[model samples]
Target: MLNSNLLRKLDMQDLMVFIAVYQQSSVTGVSEALFVSQSTVSYCLKKLRTSFEDDLFINTRTGMRPTHKACTMYAHVLKILESINLCHAGPATFDPTRQAVTFNICAPEYFEHLILPRLLKNFDFADLPVIVNMHKLETDIPADELRDGSLDLVICFGPNFHRSHPDFKSQVLVEDDLVCVFDKRATPLEPRFSLQAFVERRHVFPTPWTSTTNMVDGWLARQAYKRQIVARANSYSAALKMITGTDFILTLPRRIQKLLAKDTIFNHCEAPNGLPGFTLNMQWSQNSDPDSANTWLRDQVLKACAEQGLS
Candidate 1:
């Protein structure tokens, strides 16, 4: 249980002081980071201690060390403070043409390959100072990142993860048909995929946890079809690399196929008659802040995709 009064009394300034002290292990370091007097930093520390009913920090030869309780509470405190800061910072009034802002995005590598080139071409980040950090969908928890303010947005397939998190807002950005890719030189007798061919062929698939894989398997099961999954990888870049000059056929979104077309290492074919298309969505967390910068970012993405004639 938490003390609501204590929580209500804390603010971003307090957390900033706490984090600076925690990191540099000294009140002087905190004062420098916050551009405040040492006494002000010391005063904030006292308030934190009184509110939490904990020593929180202790002086040591190393400077100041956090107590075990402070260590345990660090992450939660940091996230809360960040949320407060974002809300208060107001709608990023900085003009996209003249201001600089860093945004962190979590997405599949294939999504990155498909969108990055167009995003850079359409949006002039030179003045905006934009930085994108791409993380593997399979390796990171995007919803958690969005909630904690570490991730500004997520572009991913399926709604499973975001559907349950109250803090997130999601919209279907595009719906793409699944296509099978293989070496163009190695053509099978059938121009279109067949259930028997699907089951018999050596298949390379993005990792089973990927929304595409889950949707494909679910569709196959509905149609009473099952394929031998020969390989599972987290990224299409990895899976496609594996399929080069080989007979392995991989099922992926058409957008991914178009992106890979540049490499000429493999070519794409349509899935057998029964498999269904999947929708890719963009998600962001909701904050009380009046800043509509996040919405602007999402609009920019959609506009970029439309300009490229990619739905």
Candidate 2:
């Protein structure tokens, strides 16, 4: 027989708040962690104290110190919360090929221009009832949105521009060398290009990040040579347009040049020998690592990269 008094007093949200308070050890921390108001956490704590017939947490100089009762409840509350998550996740029954899913991805123009077309061309996702919503990449790691289920995946240039967290998983998906693009009619260069031409010429930088500096510039700085950046465009396509029929040079990834090979208007040359290549990495929340749908999507991306010889 179950006790109706305890059952009536129990609330899932209160238990969640209790668990959060235990973990955070501060009312403000709990509020932010759970995305709730401090007053709401206080209300939940009051209910927890009444239901348990004890002040679960004691205010201390350092933080909210857990009482003996709270210490005992911690493991049990954790299990309950995890069980609730598993119930909602339903990974055991997930079938990616037939499941209805909407994936929200955060990516930069780099992914859009280079990888997405190949992925779409090689895979049939629309028929599978899969919709991919792309959001502009904001940071090296957008953990807050990913943690709250606002974003399913993130793709960005790395390993220079990467921040790792224990709750997220990342993998390098593709790599490519650098090449310098110029309009041959406007800024003709011999097959034997010299580093002097690279520095003497004005350059157009294409990058989504606010900073115009990159690995290329870092190498140049090491050698005490800095290329003059005449213009900074928000994307590579824009930079290409800005430099075409002009003397401005745009140095970008070789894969980008491969994609634009048909455009006779722009010609690419081997980058200064020592300039390093770049890598693109894909990241996802750890919670999604075991999800069948996520697994399928990641596999599809890898397949596209392998087929396109871009891996």
lDDT scores in order: 0.75, 0.80
Q: For model 2, how does the per-residue alpha-carbon lDDT over 154-258 read when each residue is reduced to its tens digit?
A: 887777666677888888888878888888676454763477878988999887654445777888999889999999888887888898778888888887777
What TM-score should be assigned to candidate 1?
Answer: 0.62
Listed per candidate, the RMSD to the true structure in angstroms reads 13.8, 15.0
Tell me how far the alpha carbon of residue 207 in candidate 1 is from the true structure, in angstroms, after superposition.
3.7
Task: State the displacement of the C-alpha of residue 299, model 1, in Å, after optimal TM-score superposition.
Answer: 2.0
Give per-residue lDDT, candidate 1, residue 124.
Answer: 58
> Candidate 1 — which residues are off by over 4 angstroms?
1-92, 124-126, 139-141, 159-163, 208-213, 262-265
Candidate 1: tens digits of C-alpha lDDT, residues 1-311? 56557766766688889888988998877788899999999888988998888999999898998999999989988888878778888545646666667777777665677666778766654445666666656633566778777877888776453245666677776777888888777667676788778778888878623453377777778877788888887677788787788888888888877776544566666788867777767878776223466766787788877877777
Give the runs in model 2 whose Cα sits over 4 Å from its true position.
1-93, 122-126, 209-212, 261-263
* Residue 176 accuracy (lDDT) in model 2: 75
The TM-score leader among the candidates is 2
